[model samples]
Target: MTEVDPLALDLPVLASLAGSAADEFLLARLRADGHEHIRRSHGYVFQRLIAGAPTVTELGAALGVTQQAASKAVIELEQLGYVERSADAADSRIRRIALTDRGREVVQLGRRLRAELEQTLLATVDPADAAAARRVLVALLAASGGLEAIAGRSVPLPSD
Candidate 1:
């Protein structure tokens, strides 16, 4: 007869641990060298901006966030001088958001920190195992609709 251990079958335990570890790592990297006002969601925003500068509406759509939420993020970013917003020449009503020097610096710092963190975590991990895990996570994210691009929005699990 096979023995079933509750701890081995506890999903919540695994989830809690994973969430805590991720939160700690994020906090460390974001706060690394006195960095501030950056959150996990900003990673996605940065990626989108790198692909190309986008209007707030376009950013919202690409990010899967509402226009208001996107605008609010832009406003905060603007206030921090991380990004600059200017009226579009072609469409005066629309505003274009671009990363400023400081924003770019923050993004680079974040990238370096993340890379270092990954290096630390993968120090002892077999390269094949790490590659597999990365593939699995990418697949899961895509399968899960790639997460909402905005804040305060819920992405339902597959069971629904």
Candidate 2:
């Protein structure tokens, strides 16, 4: 193994790098499976839609983004055949977003890939170290209020 950079010793930097690498790995797998247009950002939308259909405005609020931004993401996903917008049954004027079959498949694939990644990590690290790392990560999330977001399945995407 190569010498680690001193800056990579920082928790936040190491976490970000690890996350990026994991995302790249997942994206590559998705592409190989014919999900070429999917991006990591789409996960934000998918996470919410998995629970139930929500209006763009509602989805925006859940994602902590502006309505227009949320609408843009929905449009992109709709174009990719991952999601669909339909008139709300209660109010035709209102539009609700729902995941299409393709979207659901991607979500399932992501879950499987995530489990595979975790298994790989467990295999690579000592059992005790893996348990400790999981505890530390959970504690960090709790300290940062990320635990709630994750529990609610509405973690916001970073601003561009």
Candidates in order: C-alpha RMSD to true structure? 6.2, 2.3
Question: Model 1 off-target regions past 4 Å?
Answer: 1-20, 142-160
Between which residue pairs do clashes occur in model 2?
none
Point out the worst 10-residue segment of candidate 2 by lDDT. Answer: 6-15
Please write out the lDDT profile of model 2 over residues 56-150, one tens digit for every residue: 99999998989999999999999999999999999999989999999999999999998998999899999999889788888878877789889
Q: Candidate 2: where is the Cα deviation over 4 Å?
A: 1-8
Q: Report lDDT (Cα) of residue 60, candidate 1.
A: 84
Best by TM-score: 2
Q: Would you list the C-alpha lDDT of every candidate in the order shown?
A: 0.71, 0.91
